[model samples]
Target: MKFLVLGATGATGGLFVEQATAAGHEVVVFVRNPAKLTPRDRLAVVAGDVRDARALAEAMHGTDAVVSTLGLGKAKDPANLIADSTRALVEAAEEGGTKRLVIMSAFGVGESLPKGSAILRFLYKGGRATFADKAAGEQILTASPLDWTLVYPVLLTGKPSTENVRAIDLAELDRLPGLPRISRADVAAFLLATAVEGSWSRRTAVLTTGR
Candidate 1:
């Protein structure tokens, strides 16, 4: 499979790139700084802003799926990044005749906001702008006709891949315990699997390392 990846230089995105390329899938990374990623087999980099539909459409060629690991860098960062990118991504997909989109979102965004744990809710209050942006982006995605999978991961960590990630439905929110967490590697693994296996299409799942 060939993938067009956004945010491929970030923590989770980088791990996804490594894992995908290692598994023999062709990858095309859309990044602002292509130099950050070392060239390797089955991996290619295209330089551009994620919000640029023209560039994104150009990169969409022969892409089996599109994966995004985009996230806010800081609380103070402008929150429009994800929303803007999603807008462009949808347009690019429409123009390129691509349908599959797998994105890494947080557990507190969109419909899952009120279902977050107490501590997580508190943090979200402090980072409301960031989460709101994600919600806006999710709105744009859900409105589209494309086959999209939204993985709302809980608090992310840098721990190695445990390969024991669980995909919980929003209806099962009450069954969850305290603030759950999943590693970037695990998130990457699930994102890759979700795209390649065509699982969880047009659905939103909460990703946790817990059983």
Candidate 2:
């Protein structure tokens, strides 16, 4: 399958690119700066912002699916980024006739916030617009006519791939503390699997590292 991966310069996104290529899938990456990613076979790079629908649509051409790990890293205002980018991606996908999408989201965003501890909820709420934007992005996906999956992972680490990941429903957020962290490599693995198998279609999957 062919894949258009957003945020391919990120740690987990880089892993997704490498792993997806290794899995015998064609991978296309969209990035503003290509220096962050090393050139590799079966990996095509399209220089552009995810917010640019025309550029994104150009990259989306002939791709079988899309995986967006587009992260908002301490922007002055992150409230509109993911939501707006998601809107652009959805439109680009629709225009290109692509159907599948997998989005990487954080634990305390959207409906998952209600399932977290009061302290966690308080902290996320303190962020004001960040989580709200994520929720809006999620709503966009849920309301779209495409096949989409939202993956929520808690406390990401740079540790080696454990390959042992756990996914639970929103009702099980209390169990999160027990499984506090997950490796980016493992997160990449799950994302790749989601793109290929579409296992969690139209669902939200909260991920952790455990058997």
Best by lDDT: 1
lDDT of 1 by residue, 16-40 (tens): 9999999999999999998899999
| Candidate 2 C-alpha error for residue 32, in Å | 1.3
lDDT of model 2, residue 147: 93
**Candidate 1, poorest ten consecutive residues by summed lDDT:** 169-178
**Candidate 2, residue 195: CA error in Å?**
0.8
RMSD of each: 1.2, 1.9
Candidate-wise lDDT, in order: 0.90, 0.86
Q: Estimate each model's TM-score.
A: 0.96, 0.92
Q: What lDDT score is found at residue 182 in candidate 1?
A: 92
